[model samples]
Target: MGDNVVVSNMELERLLSMKGGKGEASYANNSQAQAIHAKSMLHLLKEALDGVELHAPNIPFVVVDLGCSCGTNTINVVDVMVEHIIKRYEALGCNPPEFSAFFTDLPSNDFNTLFQLLPPMANYGNSMEECLAANNHRCYFAAGVPGSFYRRLFPARSVDIFHSAFSLHWLSQVPESVEDKRSDAYNKGRVFTHGASEITTNAYKKQFQRDLAGFLNSRSIEMKSKGTMFLVCLGRTSVDPTDQGGAGLLFGTHFQDAWDDLVQEGLISNEKRDDFNIPVYAPSLQDFKEVVEADGSFSINKLEVFKGGSPLVVNQPDDASEVGRALANSCRSVAGVLVDAHIGDKLSEELFLRVEKRAANQGKELLEKLQFFHIVASLSFVL
Candidate 1:
């Protein structure tokens, strides 16, 4: 990925820091909601563990939450899993088996935030020191592993359960065609229909296929036979090429419009636009399944979809006007890069206001254009 498009580790930390202001708060809020979806995956893991225990009663169990940002969600999942395991063991009239966990994410993610959260979490029942000393029936350890999930980040057959939430949909990098050329297709005030086509849609699907294969292949090597993986990601259901032009389309139509507006206002120069494209991609359900099943690495155990609602309506009271404002603000952040690229630093304020005004005019009912999907899928395979 190009340095400009890739959010460096330090930048990610800064964005998550309390000092980063409302942006950080927005990110945290969104992440927390996304984390709730992780609970759906946990349900599948419990089923897989049940199946495995029927064969290997004494085998150790390890769960890795890939892309475990700041470890808040990881800690939550661990607490629930531990409780469930204890109940199961009690029914069996035996002690709980040993368990370990690994929290993995980009090196730039806030591991310090996770560490700080852990001491408090460990002290919630018994102090962390006490838990470690009393480790007999079950042992829990959490550590940050810094690396991209697209590459092998764990040893082969080292993990029993693997889970990732709202993270894998991001492409390794922006599409080369978009990155290599400065096309008018990226201009602002352009309608979504102007450039919507099956060709572009197919290209995105192929890119997702490649990334998903890489992700699953690495996991296949690291997961033991009969191991399970629960992946929940942002996805779309519509196959109409035009519907693909929604604001949710990453680094494509909506983003291009932002850049175009900035350039027209003389805020950013075309030279900078040459190097700009967001390094995120959202895939359709069919494309997602193709990548997961193609490698023969996993068997689909369950699949379900839920509305992502509006990125803007989060945590707000159910007021139509306020919801509209929230959605507009969220859209602006995504479109801001494009606007900044064209308008330069000078007119950014003006461009932002204009974008906000445009969203308000469009209103909440129209904000359904920003709706996305939360896809939950479970897979199991023999290594």
Candidate 2:
């Protein structure tokens, strides 16, 4: 296969989901950084459910979590949504409707693990009977829908509410121009937006805009009129897409340094490092607004930027090696699969080990450098 063959738009849908299972390196264990953002945004989620027109008692009240990698954070979000929504209906003296929660990601996601983690559902499916029998106290039925969010997952006007966190920044694939070796826009040495050339950066920006628009368009079609979407994802504070403090901190130099170590040792060729680029782009606040406003389907109710600790480490304890290993595990959880796809398992393991050592030796300096921001927004469909 050619260097850029893996860059196909559909191919990444299979390749880029967070690593699966319940291991220490699984996304399930390494997702606290994501949980922090989702928890902070629960108010917005409640705000969204507040606006939704509750389904009739006979109809299921549908909620969908887009890009819901197999993790507890996914369940926590749905639990909060179900709880707050039930409260809203009760306050209005209405019979709470059956709830159907759909957890969606790529087909390769660990749905089995996610289903096992749910709070003792009677049985997992869309059946209202299962919802009633699974656990009398739990009112919702949970089912995993495996697909990309850039396209429609549910039927037209079927979903009443949607939630996604730390997911939208991922483009459907590496931008084609960036992967084409002959193109000036090729991301030659760099794997991500930070420190990229203007041409390479523009490719990433355009891809994000297209993907976000597709996401909104799909949701608009699938959502009931006035249905709500609450989204939270990695974002950049700087106007410049290539700013080091934003996505660059999360996806840029540290991995490159590890790749450099492999190259120096002749374990992998420099071209192997140069050929791969992470298919994620942290949009600026302006970039997000422009796409949503242009799409003109979902009326933006709330949009704002919030900063967070490095997505890798939450508290940043005094121990450098500890933080370093945390950072490495975090990367392994999200991108280790992609790296493994590119180079192979053994080399990918070696590469992340180097990342741990490098971050440990660099210590507090590395932690400070990786601080990044998040974008949270709530939108309601408008006919």
> Candidate 1: global Cα-lDDT?
0.57
lDDT values of the candidates?
0.57, 0.82
| lDDT for each residue of candidate 1 in 1-383, tens digit (9 for 90 to 100) | 12134333234322321111235223333344445545545666576555443123356667888877654566776666655655576577675555667888766566776766664323325533354456332246566788888889988887877878777765665455443345433322332222445544455456667888999999999988787777877666666533543334433433455556766766555655544444444566777777777889888887766665545544434455554445445544433433343344346455445555545555645455665576677788665
lDDT of 2 by residue, 184-287 (tens): 99888777768899888888889999999999999989999788988988887888777746567656777778988988998877788887788888888899
Candidate 1's clash total is: 13
Candidate 2 wrong stretches, greater than 4 Å: 1-10, 122-137, 314-316
- Could you tell me the TM-score of candidate 2? 0.92
Could you report the Cα RMSD, in angstroms, for every candidate shown?
5.8, 3.3
List the candidates' TM-scores in order.
Answer: 0.74, 0.92
Worst 10 residues of 1 by lDDT: 13-22
